[model samples]
Target: MTIRTRCGAWLATLLLLASSASLQANTPDDQLIVGMNMNNLLTLDPAAMTGNEVVGMVVNLYDGLVELDPQQLTHVRPALAESWDISPDNSTLTFRLRDGVRFHSGNALTSADALWSMRRVLHLNLAQASVWKSYGFSKANVDQAIVAPDARTLVIRLPKPNDPHLVLYSLAALGSMVVLDSKTVQAHAVNNDWGNRWLTTHAAGSGPFRLDGWQAKDVLTMSRAPDYWRGAAKMQRVVFRHLQESQTLRLMMEKGDLDIASNMAIPDVRALRDDPDLSIDSVQRGTIYYLAMSMKDAHFANPKVREALRYLVDYQGINKTLMAGYGVLHQRPIQSGMPATLPDPGYRLDIARARALLAEAGYPDGFDTTLRVLADQPFLNVAIAIQSTLMQAGIRARIITGTGNQIYGAMRDRQFGLLVGRGGSGVEPHPHSSLRSLVYNPDNADSARLTNFQGWRTSFYDAQLNRMIDQALTERDAAKQQQAYFAIQQRYDQLIPALMPISQMVDSVVVNNRVQAYQPHPSATTFLRDVWKTPESLAGGTP
Candidate 1:
């Protein structure tokens, strides 16, 4: 058969599979087959998780004391611990574990398991270790910090009186403070690896679902827990197929083989915007897409030249056309809707002004520069738009593209001229979370590799900004904290660092009409807890 003919037959097979799945949904939809690009998933072990995809999957397979509020993205709500209490000094937090919760291994959930899970994260010092590090956590002091008076009572004492809001918010984060059945984990432990090897593929938690199967860079499937604490899951199983190609996702979405098309191409999303069978939903993410200048490059070292590039960026044009309504102009490290975020300065594209600035910077004939971007749209297309505008001011710009790691590794190594990156260190919806990770840098030692702090990656450091971040984080008064954050925003604008904030990221997910209550959070997390299917739709052969 020809290529097109073979492709048609392949789609026919998927449609047939989808139809077969519907035959098993007579009792409240047995499954939800989702199409996603899951190549970024690294590990199923909560402490080793780095990708949001892994976190989302593990979220269903684990539970923390607290969780992000379903409706309010910035707030927290109870999870494993039905209720909690605080000491008068604000340094001690105590939680009361819900009774009768059971792990997949039939072990009962308790405060002992909660303490063990956190200690494991600290002992391993893995991906989520920083959450504890923020509060003076150390391997030597782990036992003193977390205490379990009994199986039902868990308490944590911080070295300092930290903000309760920040503390709870940090704990609510997935992969940060999730619990594991200590007995099950330790039973499989070998040579102090803390069951990290086995837990990477297996789960030991009292959660909504239990891991059924996982294949790296391929597929991950989960079945509803037999006795979930809340109730039986709405869907019996969730199947995440690794379908990276947008064309394949689009065809599957059209054929009702996939329930949700996550990571859909902008062009495909737009084309299906008006389709009755599909629904396109979007949320303004906390990610900030920006251009960073390598301080090592002499051309970018000039202040006026850097300023000229800011004016050269056509944010409106790029957002309207190339981004296809998936980009919002956000010009600060502090994400929009944040309390201390100042009004955008609204710098318009003025070629005459850019030319004047470039001349003042001693480049009367403009200069040549390279703009590094990832080999993907939105990044590649946005870089092209920037190249077009910079040329008007005689700036000869070249675009270099590479895979995600190749480009990020270059940024980490500080070996590029200029690069456009998407970051969310400042988007924890907290000023300290944003500033410390994006703009504040106090340590520049060879031993201090704050890789999560993108500001450190750009080789930009200011002593005053460093002190300001420290003050803001420690200030207890609400008004003063807000002022400190506002002040940093103003100063960051005046002394443009290695970054030029362009726009905030907006995520688009096209789902079938059968997918109800499809709430995609600001962090780009997908939750199906409240999602249900219509009886008729569930019985239908097609989505």
Candidate 2:
């Protein structure tokens, strides 16, 4: 049979299987399936993966030094390393490896493994630059990870005395510092590309779960590792199916075919909240939804045009209408809850002010412009709202929709005048990653230099960011550190590189009552290690 015919047959089989699967209570222990609305898996390689879905899947299969508690923002507990100590001078951090931990290949983890893993992150190739830069490690210092006399001890030497957050950077490096079998990596060193080739499809971690099988853009299946350091995971198997649309996911959840579903549409989320049979988990995430303008675009170069466009936005109205009151209107890049030295300086929606600014910029009647947006329904709705708002202010704005990846690529290359996108940091939040990627030159500057979308470059802002980074490294006073962060936020507010609509986005997770200990984090990611099924609930418990 042809390849297309074979694929078609497989799809038919999946449909039939899905139909027959029992999503209701009293389902057998081995038949439970968790449905999720995840898009295409960008990459299986932890180093190369960037999307939240892919990272979430990988998180279950890999172990890091510290893990975040979903309920508390500041709390971090041990995962791979049982305990650690920092030198008084703050130049050295020593981690003691957890005993009895073994990789998927049955190799015991040692200090050498941790050293190799962190060093590789520091020297990450082009394919993994996005993940690596988030660790706040300079290339020179990363090359200096050293092992102590004890085989179980791993020490990282800093160039200078830094702060606790800098050390915490290691814990929250996300896909960057995942420990790998040192022997296997060395054996394959001569023939493999560490970041792109070997690690992309194959993983050897000491996490509770192991990668059993993976099919691109389809399903990724993992099973509990029997010899996991913390003991065998309670759930025998975990499957992640890449169902892209919200409607299909909701349908599956309603039919009792999925035990958990995330990223629900706003309307669907509201419905799920009222559903008697489902328990909905919702959290306001620390992600910013904003419109990015290409600084290199001549039309946006005029400060008056930029200010007018900012004024033309009605963030409150968009939050109320599109988000169904689920979003918080944000004024600055930094969200409100974050401990910073300054408060948010909110924006104003003044039609008269916008028109005046446009007139002053030599366009009393406004001008024509195009804004690229994601083809997703909610994002499109937002784009349409923005377009209408701008038109009302005499600016002729058109919305062009495409896949998220396509729009992001165009925006990065400065090929689009304006684009609506989201920006965020992981559990260990930091601004350097976005600063380096969005503001600085692209990875390969000699070829096609990626210009900062807002063309914003001020020595003042740069100095503030630098000071914050250095203070985050060595400062011990919590209040003082927050002051520095506040200053950084104030600088960002002044620059207005991007108009932030919402400080936080609402993420919803729907799960069957049978599934216990399902927790959601502000990052909109879950640590599924502690998730388990209750026997009583599985045995025909009432909804």
Candidate 3:
């Protein structure tokens, strides 16, 4: 057969296998098929992965020391560790490992494996190492800070003064610290890379599922580990298919081919709201969407320019019209609903004010600049909106759109002028989580290379702000810490930060009613071990 004809036949086969004429859950009862955009899923290595997409996958493949309850984010649940305790001075943390757990390779899991996994993160110094390094752990002191006294005892000594509670939250919420099968991973290491390269396409974990196969930006499949310590995953197999186009995912979900679809555009999600056989799950996330200015750029270096740009954003309009399904209006650096979080500062679009500020900044007629954004929905739309408003104030902003790699790559290298993006460290359900990721820049020198921090990426530095953030993290008195956070936000605003918060993220996923026990987590650590699907005949029934 001709190549084109063969390709056509293959697509027809997939469509045929996806559904029947009746369309009452054509998927198998023991299997789950998920559709999502995999553009950001570049790696599966726990120590190297970035973005929430990879976190959801990694948690199912590897067990963390603990996990936050999906319903109550602050509540930590035991996972690999059966129990844990902290010293009186709050300088030491000790975890008791659960016995009889084995990795997919049949190797018995031990405390040494957990300690080795953390040490590997500091050694690799990749994307996942950023948060750990911020906590004072380094490649040099990891062996001393994190030690395995016995096969069942894992202890961690703080290298610096920090809230042990926040450290515990980090261990539970961030998938980067998940325990790995040290032996299996070490066996695959190449050139002393600590198995990073090989782990990109393989997994050595003790979670409920084991990776079966993966094709980058295409399809990934995992099968339930038969000897999982907790219990076998309800689904015999789970498949994640990359469906970049939102409409394709909607159609597949409507046809019963996909049990769940994530990262779909807002309009498509709205279209399926009335579907009797489908349900929408909206999970509030700690991440924030905002407009970032690069201080390295001459136009935004001035505080007046940054303040002018902040007022140029139509927060209400964008959050009401454009961010309906994606996020809610949130202005403070800290996430909303937290006790430490303050109300929105209520900055609005005022072209005249922006014009006045621009004139004061030595640009009577605003200068031209470029705005970088991902080609994906919401981001692209928000950029367009900002571009229009910027032009109104005589500031011309050209929109440059590309894939996540192309866009974020420039931001990471500090080569962008202006960018509309989403980020914050809200995974741990703590106020410091967001401030540390978004506002804390410990080192201002370029040589520091703190690319993991958005503050560093934007060249936004303030000695007092850094001091307040550091003080807040270690402050033992809850009342004093709360006041410290308030003072930090006030100072951040007065200084005209390079990054402006526009919206707090809310992730909406369309799920087939046939799927049960599937709860999406705020931290993006969705577990599938308890998720199961009803038989096809009863798929249309209420979940």
Candidate 4:
């Protein structure tokens, strides 16, 4: 057998060594073994990493200037930055760097490194740069807009009007702005690539842990950084094994082989609820699950048809049944619990209303269309539920399921008729975050290529809605901004947006009872420095 295959077999044998009858935890007390699917872990580069799985890992391997408190998202906490201040005009932000911090490469951390990191993000123009670009930061302007006066001080001058608090939230909540070891990355730079090629598999960071090795789609291992500014991580090492099969994870967890399991199937999570040694943490994420229609397609372009599709969704039934551990019913574009979030408009599955609207839109008998969705639950299950409801209104929707890339790829290209997907930037705990991502489409032309914004992907454009979203984000008064957001939602609903919100996303993570201080953040920036596990002998079983 090949070396990789042999290694995989050996690991599998070790994992299988543990059995339920033995009831012994196979993991070491000083190490945290995490079972998860690592398919979406494409890169370690802070500017290019996508998905929550990578976000959780990146946060531990690198330190952002600030971080939002997991319990209170609005409260920004200091990290690399000892403190910060916003100018009275809300156009400038200044941050003071903490002293004595050093990167894994032993290079001293400074505001120059921070400035270089921010500039590199825009210069690279990768996945993480999109949000910063939307805030008027560009490769050309980054040098001027973001500056460092001394080794300890960094300043940012906004290119346009924006809420400084939201900007701070972006810096804290979004892992994209995390500072990097510029000297190390530059040393590894090849072909003037800014280390993008190298950082894909390597890391130059100053967080609680240092990247030891990463084998793509197989395993990722990191050990605690002894000289971490805050302190060394409680766990000596953290091993994330690629356990794609939910059943395998469940079996391993039952045998005490895994300290934590994320992205478990809902059914599997439900089965583990009664397990005494396991605890499920249902973290409420800001992203929303929704049904999207491509306005480029003639069928969905009609306002009446879009309105008909809204009434055709069985939102209540789907949330009550299919979305048990996946999500909760949420119809508005804005996520729930936010001050600006309004009550659900109380849309129900009204086949009659849908049929009448369809007829009014010149389709007496509902036309045929394809509904694309991920080939995973509860996306597949939710798509099936939607298909059944659409059929009730004489609308024939053939369900097409595929991998995330295949499905979302078609949507990004504006080539899909209908799609069941989950997205929206609730990372900052701001209404504008959701609106900017899901509803504020500045341009609908295919050439605009604002695929980062779901609004552009679905070809859902409204100048007035865009203006309102922009105005709300820049509003100085809190109450007035909230009112503006409320008005935006009301108007968005009245316009019958092509993207229909069905539920707010919830992520369930199963953890061993012995694991302590393991709080999962809503923004996906989960810090593992303080997490510890009880000793096996003291806990009466493996931890």
Measured by TM-score, the strongest candidate is 4
Q: Estimate TM-scores for all models.
A: 0.90, 0.86, 0.95, 0.95
Tens digit of lDDT per residue, candidate 4, span 450-504? Answer: 9999999998888988898889999999999999999999999999999999999
Clashing pairs in 1: 426-434
lDDT, candidate 1, equals 0.78
Expressed as tens digits, the lDDT of each residue in 1-543 for candidate 2 is: 454664465455455555567444233343236666555466677666666677677777888877666677556677787888888877677888787788877788887787777666556644454434433455666666455557788887755555555446535545556677777766656444554566666567777787666667677667777778787777876777778777888887877677787766768767777778788777766566777665556767677787888888777788777866346676555444654524445566679999998899899988888888988756788888888888988888788888866887676555777777775443445443333333333233324332232223111124555555555545677776666656656665566554444435666678877787778766534677777766644465322
Residue-level lDDT of model 1, residues 247-266, one tens digit each, is 98887787676788788888
lDDT of each: 0.78, 0.64, 0.90, 0.90
Q: Which residues of candidate 3, in runs, are more than 4 Å off?
A: 1-25, 539-543
Q: In candidate 3, what are the lDDT values of residues 374-451, reduced to their tens digit?
A: 988799999999999999989999999998879988988999999999999799989989998899999988889898
The TM-score of candidate 4 is 0.95
Candidate 2 Cα outliers beyond 4 Å, as residue runs? 1-27, 30-32, 126-128, 131-141, 146-149, 160-162, 185-190, 341-343, 429-474, 498-501, 536-543
lDDT score for residue 450 of model 1: 62
Cα RMSD (Å) per model? 5.6, 4.7, 4.0, 3.3
lDDT of 4 at 237: 79
RMSD, model 1, all Cα superposed?
5.6
Off by over 4 Å in 1: 1-28, 366-368, 536-543
For model 4, the superposed segments whose C-alpha errors exceed 4 Å read 1-24, 540-543
